[model samples]
Target: MASFGWKRKIGEKVSKATSQQFEAEAADDKDLADDDEANWVHATKRRKEILLEDCVKKSKELKDEGANLAENKRYREAIHKWDEALQLTPEDATLYEMKSQVLMSLHEMFPAVHAAEMAVQRNPRSWDAWQTLGRAQLGLGEIALVGKQTRV
Candidate 1:
């Protein structure tokens, strides 16, 4: 009976040690999973930032090319370049305003007005946008739309 009791004690001790070891391994796995999730989130944010920077750089280059083209009186090509820039930076009010002016030079009144309106929508405080809008409206024979408070 005494020997049997000692064997039972040894069995309980082994069982407890095995249970503790499993719990410790589970904790380590949970921690590793948490770290992996955190790393993924950080990497995703960095990728987004990189994409934005690339877009901005490309858009700036396109805008400069468009400006040079416009200066040389290549109106259609300038408009195309500006359109490509706008695709990258749709919220750029200046691009829209420039496009509006080019459209006006082409005698495209409706499109000019639309582009100028988009400029104004993007930057309501831009006097250039307002001026372009007013001129485009006038060219479209909508003088009534060009109110006395025209910023231009």
Candidate 2:
């Protein structure tokens, strides 16, 4: 009788262990299925190439307007327009160059130098920005000389 009872207990333990293992395997399979579904959803989304092209076109238009204002000798107004262009595309070296030129025309030498420096910072490959910076520095030097002469 004692032997029979021990055998029955062992059989019950084996059954519970098998049930726990089956539940763990089912959970892992469900997680894998969820991951596959997420991947499929992401693959079906549309790309945004056209929107990017439109932004570039608008930036060019604003830059052209800034140039027109500068050519008309409206330096402050040109700077305002260039500022708008910069707001649209802050990484544009040409817009910064235009702003620097406009500021220089208004005799705002320090601000001109700062704008040129910003252009170089935004695109270090721009020779135009470097030239503008040099010219602005020369203007500042002349102003400094004038101040010294006046002090004498």
Candidate 3:
């Protein structure tokens, strides 16, 4: 009877120690995973930020070159430069607006309208885009579409 009691006590002690070791290991693993996740997230965010900065810088350079070309009356070259800028910033309403004006200078009515429409779509609240769209529509001989007379 005494021997049975001693054995039971030893068995309980061993089980408790094993459980504590497993708990400690689990905690360490969780800490490692959390650190790894945090590092990965931070790196990804920084990489995206760097890429956006680069794109904005390059787009600006292209836009400036295009504006200079347009000012010099090199309409086709200006259009080409603006097109490259658009590739970097497709959602830029100003780029589309500039392209629309260049196309108008070239008497490309269809393309001008298309570019103006794209500008309007990208910036619905922009007065310049709306004005460009109206002008392009008028140039395309869509005077009826631009306005209609109503009896007062």
Maximum-lDDT candidate:
1
Instruction: Looking at model 3, report the run of 10 residues with the lowest lDDT sum.
Output: 1-10
Give candidate 2's error at residue 43 in angstroms.
11
* Cα lDDT tens digits for candidate 3, 1-152: 34544334545557887988988999999999999999999999999999998998999999999999999999999999999989988999999999999999999999999999999899988889888888989998888877741111
Against the hidden true structure, what lDDT does model 1 obtain?
0.93
Ordered list by TM-score, greatest first:
1, 3, 2
lDDT tens per residue, model 1, 88-137: 99999999999999999999999999999999999999999999999999
Write one digit per residue (lDDT tens) for candidate 2, span 1-152.
44544334545556887988988999999999999899777655423455566667888888888788789887777787778877767888878887887888889998988898898798877778877777777788865744553354
Cα deviation in Å at residue 75, candidate 3?
A: 1.3
Error of 1 at 122 (Å): 0.9
* Position 142, candidate 1: lDDT: 85
Top model number, TM-score: 1
Q: Clash pairs of candidate 2?
A: none
Candidate 3: residue 56 lDDT (0-100): 87
